[model samples]
Target: MSRNRTRFLKEFPKAISDENAAVFIGAGVSVGAGYPSWKELLREIGDELGVKSDDVYDLAALAQWSVSDTGGATRIRQVIRDQIAVDHDIPAPLNILARMPIRHLWTTNYDRLIERALLAIRRPCSVISAQGDLALKVTAGAARVYKMHGTVDQLDEIVISTDDYELFRSRRGAFLPLLQAHLSSFSMLFLGLSFTDPNLRHVLSLIRESFTDAPPAHFAIVRPPQKGDFRSAEEFEARLAQHNLWAKDLQRYGLFAIEIEDYDEVPGLLAEVERRVARNRVWISGSWPLDEATTPEVSFVHDVAERVGGVVGSSGLTLVSGSGLLVGSGSMSGFLSSLQKTGAWDLERRLIVRPFPQPIEGGEPDRAQWDLLRAELARLAGHVVFIGGLKAEAGALVDSSGVHAERAIAQAKGAYLLPIGATGGAAATIAAELIGSDLRFDGPDALRPSDEQLASLGDASVGAAELANRVLKILKSRML
Candidate 1:
């Protein structure tokens, strides 16, 4: 990763945890969801007026010309409703945005892509297009999206054409002040926006004038102009130079640029941000057969859990585990007791057990309930550590513990996995599988267990301290 990206990954988690984070979206994000870019929208309008689309640089002016030629905004409104009012499903990138914990979203787009995305994820969002909407009391657990340019739902209020841009201060009323407040109060991540939007430029200018000192630092994800897209190398270099200059100028408004190679990288970066923000939570999964427990295997599970609990207690990372009768409760109970002895047991922060729903009469949980619990654990944890369990019982295709570990690995997407094969059984099988396969773990290469290490994991002599040390090493390396 580049230095800027590293810095972002390291710092953004704290911002999210503090509830000081916000996102400012632009047309580029909506374009990916089937909407046209500002240039494209204006160029199409210009084409209708016998103007060469490529020759028109001032999109607002072009919009004004089209409205003037038609003698009303009816045709322009129709064009906007036809072009910007997309009813398609939200794209992956937008879905990531929808799932983010940030409660505030500011967009210059006129479409409902952002709102629709939030809806898709079942995240209730209060839309703010007019000043009156801001006066309405905010609902708890709902995100607030401030449409700075207006939305397609209200055509007359949309900020397009040179006239609207010129009259923005008077027409938008208190919207600018509310925007200024958010800019000062929150650490913002700017997405899918070019810094050149005249409306955005005006807002930044207002913010700059209001604050004597620098406001909270903000970030803008920018794509460097591609070399292959330009007609000539010289043209590409010139465009890059201009972009760099613009990036530098943005510092005056306390905005830093996170330059990326392409737009496709945006979703991945956002997903990583979400992952790192939840990094302090670790999940422990495994199930040993109580009737056939070996002394060494039992000793290994308790030792690993004890060491992990000590580390988690001291470092403030929460331990999220299942409530399985065998491995889950047996291991974690000892882990908690160890923490209590060290004055590190805090129920609110140190431990979280997502228990499987049980029958009222007291029997093994139904398959559906067990599966649901596994899914929840996978969703909650940033890292999962699998210990020892049976590989299979009788004619079963696979051990239930191994299946749960696999489900977690798949569902968590980028979660860190540490399978201690030394403990043997299902964990050893998982370790062997991972080491033998071609899949890459999502972290520094040094953090991943080597082939030689995997081969040694099945050894019965490896103690709990050593296994604990290995898991700690991976976690600490990632923090660095």
Candidate 2:
């Protein structure tokens, strides 16, 4: 079946519905955060031992043989820890996961990145390490970080080498139950892994054998236009069909592959993910903040929004000053002039005002008006606030806005309320509050407004003076 926006969004809700969702990550996730891939790490080890990258396979085999002759697994552990001191924290991906809402994490790699991330988030969690403690406890009801493979800190616990792998294979009874429970209930979002890893292949085989009747669905992200060893999109769909995995080509919706061209890009990508997770709770009302405006009143709304751009969130409650905010230009002009004269004068922190236009007797939102409004909203920056009442008839202006706003706030994302009461005045008030709180120009340590700033925003007409006053009020409030 073809996967589209509807299907993905629908599935996404299900995937994230559980606060204790299971997450199976692979080395690729770390690689995106700038850590070396398994192949790259192996090559690095080979190079350190005076061997070429292509000679990695043979050299690894030789190393394994040497270890076998000298107590095998124990000696190999010493080789990795002493001779190869892999920088465990040099490039950490835990920072990325720390921002996500996911609690449960399972990985085959022996790295401590996930544990580090969990600790950073300050969430109580249990780390299952083969070397340190196999004492699995479910009573805490807290998230668990199961390191199916051993970690670097313990030599005897390492899961490398053919013999060690075999031992784990035979000892599957220890961890299989937990894995099965997680797999059966949670929708898995696999990262930095593919169908190629032998360990993954074996895990999939075991899963297939365990749940022969009706296996849980699986999902994996693959870079588009499948390269080298990656299964083609069509082939992946067929492979997943065997284990009930329904593959979706993320590229169709602008996120097919990790798409990391350089190491520097990883940080930015991780930051974006952090921002999205944080923003996921915010919801906007009023003018959609992104919608276009039609009249000078609507234009005023857009102007306010543009100025208050810094504060508007994607999932926060955004009440647009709707029909209730629109009034005669004479009343608006007075409010604007009052604001301009009384508010602070900081040009650096812009204040946006969205105009709410009264429809011409029988008219709806005009095309030209919407186009102008959209352009204005697009120009918003710094902080955004809404006033007046626009959708009062639907009651959505109150209900939906509150739900979304609270959700955003719970996420530690910011949202402001202007109480859809005072036409453009509320917008000005909200802007003032944010400015007062802004550390940039507060206290004896505040930014002084320049003369040009006062002159440019002096007039009060067509929403210009009101916006200027809003800016001034923010600056003045913060100074106190």
Candidate 3:
């Protein structure tokens, strides 16, 4: 199980990096956001109808029974509305999921927590919550959310009754086929789902039935059956056996389960995956007014930036470019040249240029907003490179505050620091501070920067090509 978990943690992020990832969320994720689980929601309905929730094993049947007693779905809908109407906080795991590179989200939950999380990150989302929405087009690069079950807002159409389940494919139109298509193609992560939904099982069965031995690989995060969850040793053992078989059955359908000890470990697992995905993405920090300086040192700095960018591209890593005058162009050119050498000249593929919004409309430049922008971008990088970060102030050069801010942000986000100290200004100062305080070096030995190479980064005499090669070596040493 540990090996399977390791495999998922290692390779799933690559699916995201390759833009072939999708996520299927469930009621469990909404449970973390203060909403009731299926059992809890059933309990509420059970109490309403003088029925004990514990008497039923099939949750959908329990919901259908409530609908039957009401003579319509109205009372059941009211119960649902009253039970989960509170404003809920977006949980940590969901926030992390939103920040990931994944663009597709499929969920059976009725709540808007997923949308809210994406909205928090300002990710434009196209939500397909009902049959009619299937006709809509998902904008390029926009997040796509498929709410398979009807949302709580449309209470009359919500799928809680057996009749609704039976008629889902007919009533909901192509939802089942659409889900099946996605499941067949994308590398999906199943989060918080019980795998008990008849609709989901149908899709899984279709995928399995049409399989050619090697199906599209998928993953799920599940909690292993706990001994404390059952009454007797026999009961616990049976539950454990059942859990193991269920895990094995999922593998038959191509979903490898990664069992965690507890649900509380979810956020940490997600954070680690995010970190792993961010590695290999190099974000260079620092800016210089190349037009204002004619010194040979400045020329050396520009050369170093371009050389490093080329290595980053040739090594199959990404360059997250900054908009600093000369340095940005130099690095972009180098990155493009690397792409051209490989017969792939698409800059958009190898380079990321996320420009920041300048000064606020009414007042001075928004420092806080700029910091937020910088932090957001830094989170997407596994390493930060600093070089010639200086700005002209009162006819003299001073350290760029933005560069220093980026180092702090990158450090907090676990980004590797690769400062070219020979270029001087903010980068040199940062390198000096880092070396003197051993701040960035205070990590596991394997993950730490090489002491000899670290010193060369700050050496004024280090050549641009050597510095770039050193940077490549350091980057490779940390690849896990």
* Sort by lDDT, top down from the best: 3, 1, 2
What does each candidate score in C-alpha RMSD?
5.1, 17.8, 3.0
* Candidate 3 Cα errors over 4 Å, as ranges: 48-50, 195-203, 206-212, 231-234, 343-350, 356-364, 393-395, 436-448, 459-462
Candidates ranked by TM-score: 3, 1, 2
Screening candidate 3 with a backbone cut-off below 3 angstroms (N, C-alpha, C), the clashing residue pairs are: none
Q: Which candidate number would show the highest TM-score if scored against the true structure?
A: 3
Model 3 alpha-carbon miss at residue 240, Å: 2.6
Candidates in order, TM-scores: namely 0.75, 0.49, 0.90
* TM-score quality measure for candidate 2: 0.49
Report every candidate's CA lDDT. 0.72, 0.44, 0.79
Predicted candidate 1 versus true structure: per-residue lDDT over 59-160, tens digit per residue:
778888988999977888888998887686677777887776688998888988888999876789899997677789877869999997789999988988
TM-score preference between candidates 1 and 3, better one? 3
Model 3 TM-score, 2 decimals: 0.90
Compared with the true structure, model 1 gives a TM-score of 0.75
Over 4 Å off, model 2: 1-10, 32-36, 40-64, 82-93, 131-142, 210-217, 224-419, 422-480
User: Which is the better candidate, 2 or 3, if ranked by lDDT?
Assistant: 3
Worst 10 residues of 1 by lDDT: 439-448
